[model samples]
Target: MTETPSTMQMVSFAAWRDGALHSGRQADRRYVTLAELLVRLGSFGLGLSWKARLFDRQPHPAFAQMVKASAGSGIPTLELLATDAPYRQAVDGDFEGYAGSELALTLREFDSSCWEVRTADAWVLSEIQRHYPDARPMTSDEWDTTT
Candidate 1:
């Protein structure tokens, strides 16, 4: 089932990253649903497995992108994240990512709730977005404008 970006609506990136803590401008792009993203990247099997593991819990597509970004930024492993995710709770406080990795990269979801976490660094995104379709980072305008 290949879904288009026009079909679904996503939560705002600001909603997830808010308050004085929020830094760096977020890009404006539409996100694909979890199913669409899985099919987009041929990661359906993994998505399904994760869905099953989570008992089909928040089946939104954004999660896949979250996992991808977190790992790429070397923030922390999902296994560690599982210890404290924003589900069924007030989200055990903020997650200040480890610095010194020099990773200006972060994750951002689209209005469709589909997302990718790539560097806020424009030069890097232009080079990498093509290779990793789902995880491509882009400038705000580039993200907003449909190619």
Candidate 2:
């Protein structure tokens, strides 16, 4: 059975960057749980299996992008399956561990761009609010009317 997603509200923040409409700044995006905020925690750790660790330590840019996509898709957690990955089955040895290999595979095969954008926006807003308590989310009108 598929697990139902928990009730999670996502806030967003937007700012001018590099004089561009879509700056695509990395640090400008972030996300966290409301409960986590209450306790002053930003992220949760997901222990990976040995196989998954192989890709995780030095993940390619695409790999990181895929992770963002998954997170955006409401994947609360990424799990490493017990089965061996077909990609590296030939070099298989005593590689027994629950790594996030399944997640990697899924991301590589699927596309979740829309979800990624949505989640990333929320993440950025959350981070900004967390770091700058006084800095409020602004509207186009507010920005224009300010100065």
Candidate 3:
């Protein structure tokens, strides 16, 4: 079943780059739920037998627009927050696929020099903090405004 807006968990995050909190000017537009993000970005198919495979999925049209608009400093680290249960995509058929929560999503720079992490799991967030001590949590007001 599709989750209602109220039941769906909203994720928001603050990004850090060059040892400082990067101005997340584009965050409001870039950040979205893992499901929506995946849909927007699309994926290549793996030869796996699972039903969950994307199978050379094509990205939404807005993805190109987003890329065109994304001209700014890159943030290497991003810590996401979500208070509700994690989002899951259910699949059908005999294989059943692997049933696991999508705990995190990462977007890497084109040069592979940097990456951004998005997660709802506290443990993952803590791990991010351990590595990037300068990373800061987003204020409720910021989350309220951005999401």
Best by TM-score: 3
Please provide, for model 1 over 1-147, each residue's C-alpha lDDT reduced to its tens digit, 9 standing for 90 to 100. 232334222212222312233358565443232333223333211222221112133533444344444544333333333432323222111122233443233233333233443333344344334434344324555544521
Best by lDDT: 1
Record all residue pairs in model 1 with backbone atoms less than 3 Å apart, i.e. clashing: 10-111, 10-112, 10-113, 34-61
- lDDT (tens digit, per residue) of candidate 3 on 1-147: 122333222222333234334586443323223333223322210111111112113434333223233223211111111211012221110111111222133322111122233334355455555654654554435434421
Q: State candidate 3's TM-score.
A: 0.27
Residue-pair clashes per prediction, in order, are 4, 5, 0
State model 2's lDDT. Answer: 0.27
The Cα error of candidate 3 at residue 67, in Å, is: 9.3
Residue 95 lDDT in candidate 1: 22
Regarding TM-score, does 1 or 2 come out ahead? 1
Deviation (Å) of 54 in candidate 2: 21
Per-residue lDDT of candidate 2, residues 30-144 (tens digit): 3222222212212322342222111244445443443344342323323322122322211101111222433211111111111100112245445546654543444434323
Which candidate do you rate higher for lDDT, 1 or 3? 1
> TM per model?
0.26, 0.21, 0.27
- The candidates, ranked best first by TM-score, are 3, 1, 2
